[model samples]
Target: MTAEIGPPKSANPEIVRRYARLLREHGDAFNVTDNQTAIVRMSSFASALICLQEGAEPIMQMTCRDRNRIALQSDLLGASALGVRNVLCLSGDHQTFGNQREAKNVYDIDSTQELQMFKMMRDERRILGDDELEEGPKMFLGAVENPFADPFEFRVARLAKKVSAGADFVQTQAVFDMERFERWMSAARDRGLDRKVHIIAGVVPLKSLGAANYMKKKVPGMIVPDHIIERMRKATDAKSEGIRICVEQIEHLMTIKGVHGVHIMAVNWEEKVPEIVEKANLHPRPPP
Candidate 1:
């Protein structure tokens, strides 16, 4: 669920509630944002709690760029107290990339350290400094993996490090280069990571030629192929064609042995997800 507020503040209740309603109606878990792309959006936890009230399961996104270790740990506890179970930990985009470019960056602890802290609280029933908890919070830990990141050879190694640090699952960056993604998946399987973690491939259907171009040229750690861009350029109905491309990608992903699931991130386009899911025949999701 992409709740891009389009420069609006969080006080606009509709921004959160409307997306929450969409998630509930579609029976899809919501992924509320925490200043994604370094833009100041609604607090991820706030959106998550709103979605929870609307009867949708939410995955709160946390980043290390803004909060220190103490704040992170406190927020985790607060999130748990508010009934949040799943979390996606990220190192976060740099502050200079967002509207608040002048704001100081606070990467007091890196993502790996944050992952370890989460693991400590959830698995070992302890937090940083090794204080014991009579009962630990039940959390479904998740992390981000950018297969398109530079030094591609090290991508899998980074993923492995996250898993070792205590990630239960990984939601990768938006994938458009299927060939590259296949190679990455092969590496993941070869390294036996498929057995250790649930890997959810991210898919963001192109809305237009402009969106495709923006992704290819602007987004960091993203890989959009030239052919996809050309196809969008020539297509009369770019939006429909984008959905077709995404469906094809989902179909291909289903055949890959190590792939566990597809995380469709149709930003601010939640309305299109049900169509994509239906076209991909993902209805009546399998039992756990």
Candidate 2:
């Protein structure tokens, strides 16, 4: 499983270490988000290094929203020198949603282009402008997709494009609508996209009725079915019910084709991850 962890707002090494240790105990690799939601936080690179020091593998997420191509390339070189192996390229959330509304966004290149650059850097030992490097970043590249997004027929096609662009693996947005996810997976399998890349499905445990509602109505590119919301509403202990539902989802996800693994995103309720993993019988994670 890939555990998603956000760095704290300030430089708090101890907090990072605590969460990294927790996730490493129950997860194969923990993902350090890059300024998630376009809000500022500790840099993903520093938090990832803390994870590495704590003996945990990190999937460092890099977004195109904040950095230019020159900075992106420089960061990649630094990450490689520092032994950060896994990288997930993303077109991040808009600055409007973030606290720093005045920030000027940069989309120097989209996520697909970034993936191509990473592939070239690794396979060809060349950066942009055809400049040769003494050594390229030996990275296991990743990308993200939203199967729940509209224009549903195109989701799998988009995934195929990312694979063609050199994504070694792809993690999808949270799956609240399983039927849609199943259909998407079926299409992916038909296109043999699953064989080309590892597909890690996303699953989030709803912490409250309000949280469910926000995702259902507020979050763009999110599709939370009415049934899920109703489940959250009718539950007595929403948190416990949420965890149970998440465990069930993970179990059900295992039976689906083309689902390589699950990314359990317990946002702020991260301490509950071990319980979820144990209840789902995914504990005793294999070694790195």
Candidate 3:
């Protein structure tokens, strides 16, 4: 039997409406910013909620760095109430990477724990307060994976654990080494995760030699090969070249069997999403 590939067909009417409006107004694609360390801040969450209310499928990325359980629950509930259904739970970047160097780190719960909490709330119909209603928010829970992590043997197991804990989908760390990623996918399949979860590969276009070098040295678990570095070096105008590279990367990623979609991390270049999507020929596959 052929393995099922592509996003699930379920869609909430509110989510659909939001998606349509975003496309009509801003073009046909969008993603949340990853540069911010604390994604659950009221301002950031409010802005994201507005995007969802406008009919965009805002993938609200929640991090464990800034919020305790109270704050996390408040934001999650708010997101659900606002028609934001998809979530990407993460452990977040260390404080040293952000502008706020003195900010406190809250690993009160890691990504896995957070995933489990969401699942419990959804399944049991309860949160911290008994007065809260039993019917929980609908969410397409997602998690992140780094294929380049050491002790490669643990990667598949870790992915399996996340799925078991209730991750409906996964977005991998930026993939410059497609071969290694492909192998990891194959192993994940052999371990039986391929049938259970959707995988969206992360692709970030190199903006310049400085950017590429910075990611290699500063960013954890991100690797851009020398050839891609060379390509960036040869481009006369780095930004345009980066966009072109992103377009090409998405095109190539979409062709991989068992691949569901591509998550574009354009950083702050949100305007470039639609162009890359159009160039790559990725449309919402009709619900199967």
User: Highest lDDT, which number?
Assistant: 2
Model 1, 165-204: lDDT tens digits are: 9999888888889889999999999999999999988889
Clashing pairs in 3: 18-55, 18-56, 19-55
Off by over 4 Å in 2: none
lDDT of 1 at 66: 97
Instruction: Encode model 3's per-residue lDDT on 193-284: one tens digit a residue.
Output: 86799888888867788898887777878777887788888889998888788778777776776677777765544446556666666544
Indicate which candidate wins on TM-score.
2
TM-score of each: 0.94, 0.99, 0.83
Residue-wise C-alpha lDDT for candidate 2, range 99-119, written one tens digit per residue: 899999999999999999999
RMSD (Cα, Å) for all candidates, in order, is 2.2, 0.8, 6.8
Better of 1 and 2 by TM-score: 2
Of candidate 3, the 10-residue stretch with the lowest lDDT total is 1-10
lDDT over C-alpha atoms for residue 225 of model 1: 92
